[model samples]
Target chain A: MSESYEATVTDPVSAPMTCDSNPVEEWLRMDRMPHIWCPGCGIGTSVNCFTRAIEESSLDRKNIAIVSGIGCTGRVAGYLLLDSFHTTHGRALPFATGLKLASPKTKVVVYSGDGDLFAIGGNHFIHAARRNLDMTVLCVNNFNYGMTGGQVAPTTPEFAIASTTPYGSVERPFNLPYLAQSCGAVYVARWTVYHVKQLQRSIREALEKPGFTFIEMVAPCPTLFVRRNRLGDGLAALESYEENAVIKNGADTRECDLGMGGPIVCGKFVDIDRPSYLSNQVAHLRKVLGDRYVMPDAWQGVVQ
Target chain B: MNADPRGVLTGSHFLDGDHAAAEGALAAGANFSAGYPITPSTEVVERLAGRFPFTGGTFIQMEDELAASIAIQGAVWGGSKALTVTSGPGFSLMMEHLGYGIMTETPFVLVDVQRGGPSTGLPTMPAQADMMQARWGSHGDYEIIALAPSSPQECFNLMIRAFNLSEKYRTPVLLMMDECVGHMLERVVIPSPEKIQIEPRRYTRKGPDEQYWPYSLEECNNGDLVPPLTKVGEGHFPHITGLTHDDRGYPAMNAKSQAVLLGRLVDKIRNNADDIITIEEDGTDDADVIVVSYGITARVCQPAISRARAEGHKVGFLRLVTVWPFPEKRIRELAGRVSAFVVPEMNLGQIVREVERCSQGRPKVRGVTHAGGAVHDPEEIYNAIREVMG
Candidate 1:
């Protein structure tokens, strides 16, 4: 329905590495190739940035988990070459919460979408943040629910046309960074899929934090959200980021509500510290129960 | 294996069924539980919270049953035996994650204390009505192991078996306790750590870098009915999904994928139903009437069955300990000889249907139904037996 500037980009011809030597190939399920993401869709771009970020992060590939809920972004887990859990709709946080509390060592990341994260799963998002659970939450905000065909979402901007809101969305949208920050997330950041380097760096930084941290990448649903709302193609949407993106490092999150095609305030804001759920549980139980409390030993289930 | 000594009470005590279930979980080496308080099931958490401090276990009061159910699955993959308990309304809230546990083959215990309900019908009363829901509540084609306990002592004893089955088969084993038994007071004996045998989780033998197939139905040397699983953090890098998955644990949606994954999910319990099912049968060999019952209803039917036998009416009792994998094969084989089956349950006829289906119309199947606030009267069961005998 729409077209944007196509990249005249090409990879430089170089010595090709075999599958065993290539980290990207090693970390991806090649059998599930030709991903479902439409051409020029921003989710694939976001995933590419994530893989690059994984390559850069200090965590081992085997110790990181990618958990997702039901949505387009939810498919992120199946494509990755890590231990992932594709759980029920809006239930990813609680599932990831269990995994983190049980293992206490895996770097758990929830990669989901706007509708899945802030809509049906809103309660879990706030509670997980309030508990300061030790995990990373990455939400790819495409302005609407992309999987079920562009329905109006909790994060859908005011007056935006969606399948449910044929006239336009009358409800004011939630500024996810503000919500996560207010709910006690230790770190909060926002970027676009177009800002690949910045997004990857922010993800790496969030992964390093020991308590609840959240990163929002504003992506484009060129197939549905863009075509339905007349918002141009995904590349044009990316270019819109180039034109309207403002690097506001410490802007008040209260003023960060995104518009249909307005200035996007992006940066790492609200980076602080708090004791995670397990750390506090361990400390409090030791003090109260004392000698009676047996420290949990993670020895028995470790595979050779 | 013996229980961790700290968790074992190693003495006889008068505890309610709910409390016995909690103690039994700890004695069976359950190190984690996530639960939300609901009627008839709250005492399980009440007991666990008080006892977990000394037992090296963790009990978290989750936000809701949805969180509680899925949270235990996390604990299972985190490297501990785990469980969650709830009542009817909360149990309904857990069906989705219940399916998740079945699909992912995660081993965790879910104890549903039966309160009467289509919707909060009897919050504080007993019902064996959830008997069908336990077997068919989750959406999809799958089978699960569900056990019903008639007395507080069996609640303690069977709670251990529940966890053992969860580990042995890598599935969510349902401890389907009803309100009557949950609140019922009886003497429960806690065995010493050495005398108690607990099945440790069947962990993966594959090395960290080895290709650990989470759902491979292939044969290991020991011939485990279920595949062993590795901890999420132990460098397995395995992927788990509720979708119909292949051997590698990746979601593959197709006819072939469904057949491979769902076929095993149902067969893992069905193929081993012989080991999973336990029942108490008496005089069924030569009885004209067999009274089929479970949970507190089974206990209620006992005196009635005994009185019928005393009068020389040729009555017998068939008590179900594992209500699901519903002893159909045995019932089918017995139908040829017995004149009738008298099924007395708290709910208005749930398990009776299973009995009817398996009977193949060989003998008359009579349902002695109740609305479920209270247990069936002894005379009611006795009358059903006499009528069936006539």
Candidate 2:
């Protein structure tokens, strides 16, 4: 055979493209692929950033466990190649809280969506932060509930059209960063799908923090949020985020609220040190019991 | 297997049922518990909170019952033997997660210190009304093992059994305690660790190099139908979900997968009913009338049974220890010979329906129903037995 013909047959560059060549493929359940995400949905992009963050973090893959509640983002747990749990709707924070307490050496991440984390699971989110549980919560905020059609969510900005609020929502939306910071989260950040590098960096930083860390990634629900509000397609939504998002690290979280068709504030808002729930518990018990206090079996080597 | 000695108190003490249940959990080698404070059941967690620090156990007071229920499951996945305690209102809130546990085949114990309720009817009062709720509250066709403890001693004894059955079957086991039993003080003897047998969690023996499926029946080696569990950091990379899943524990939302998954979940408990069901019988060999009772009512029926026996009636007594597998075989066998069954319980007619169904019209079943707050009078139960034999 001629040299050109041999090169065409033998070169990897001329081979048919497969997902096996993708770097993130190792972190995902490729067997379960053909993911359920809809066309132009931004959740897949956020997940890509998450896989990159996991790769960059110093934590061992075997020592990391991901938990998710019922929503479109909840499916992230099932797709990840790790010890993952798809828990009951609105219970991911508490589930991860228990996992962290039981295996203090394991890095537990609660990956869920706006409605699953804020509406039904709102109480757990607030309490987990208030207690300063050692876990990271990555909330993919698409504004409305995307999994169950575009229903009005707690994070849905006022005057945005949703299936449950076809006449337009009148209730004010929750400012998530402000909520997390006020509830005693040691690390809080916000970014959009368009800001992939920043989002991945924020996730890595949050993973290294001890106490409860919250990161809100504002993504697009083109089939619902964008289409219903006439905000164009997913690409248009990313362009809008690129055009309007302001990066102001250390900005007061109270001023970080998002309104309908308004500028999106994106940056780290809170980073501080606080004793986590388990550490506080151990410290208090050791003080009271003195030599009688024995570290829990799971925390024997990890604590102290 | 023997329990861990650190968890065993190993002494005799006058304790309430709730406290004894806590000691029982410790003796069973439960290293983690998450619970919320509710009426009557609060003492169980209160005792655990006071003792867990010393025994190398972790007890968390979650925000609500829903959180507590799911938190224990997370701990189980993280390689801790875990449990959660609550009362009627809180137990209702935990129904969804109970179904989640059953769907995932997660082994954990739930202690429901029963109080009167459709919705918080009587918080501090005695009631056996939640018995049916414990069996059927979760919305699914699944079987769960539920045990009723009649005294503080039984509370300590049965909790260990509850944990063992849960691990053996890989299902949630309910420790059903009424307000009376939860609050009643009695002498409880806690055996030494060597004397107490504990079934360790059936963790998969497969190494990281081998493929391990979370729900694969092919991995079942003990002939019990339960697939061994895998811990989070074990490198099994198991995917556990509440959705109907295939043997690999991945969501298989189709009719065939649902049938296989739900069928196994139900059959694991039902098929093992012979080994799982426990009942106490007296004078049942030759009797014209049998009185059925459980929980506090079982103790109440004792005096009534003695009164009927004194009157020369061939009255037999049956006390249910494991209420859920319902002791159907024994009840049916006795029903073929007995003329009637007198069931005196605190509820309107919960387990009596089971007795009636099991008898299959072979015997007349009478339910001596009381609507909470107090135990049945021995005279009332005696009269029911007399009426059945009159």
Q: Considering every candidate listed, which one attains the maximal DockQ?
A: 2
> Mind giving the per-residue lDDT tens digits that candidate 2 earns over A1-304?
3553343233434557776477899999999988898766889998899899989989999999999999999999999999999999999999998898889989999999999999999999999999997899999999999989999999999899999999999999999999999999999999999999999999999999998999999999987898789887777899999998999999999999899888899999999999998889888899999999978888987876
The lDDT of each candidate is 0.86, 0.92
* lDDT measured at residue B200 in model 1 versus the true structure, 0 to 100: 86
Which candidate number maximizes lDDT? 2
Worst 10 residues of 2 chain A by lDDT: A4-13
Clashing pairs in 2: none
Q: In model 1, how many backbone clashes occur?
A: 0
Q: List the residue pairs that clash in candidate 1.
A: none
Give the Å error, residue B220, model 2: 1.7
lDDT by residue (tens digit), candidate 1, A143-181: 998888889999888999999999999999999999999
TM-score of each: 0.95, 0.97
Model 1 misplaced regions, further than 4 Å:
A1-23, A299-304, B219-225
Interface RMSD of 1: 1.3
Compute the DockQ of candidate 2: 0.72
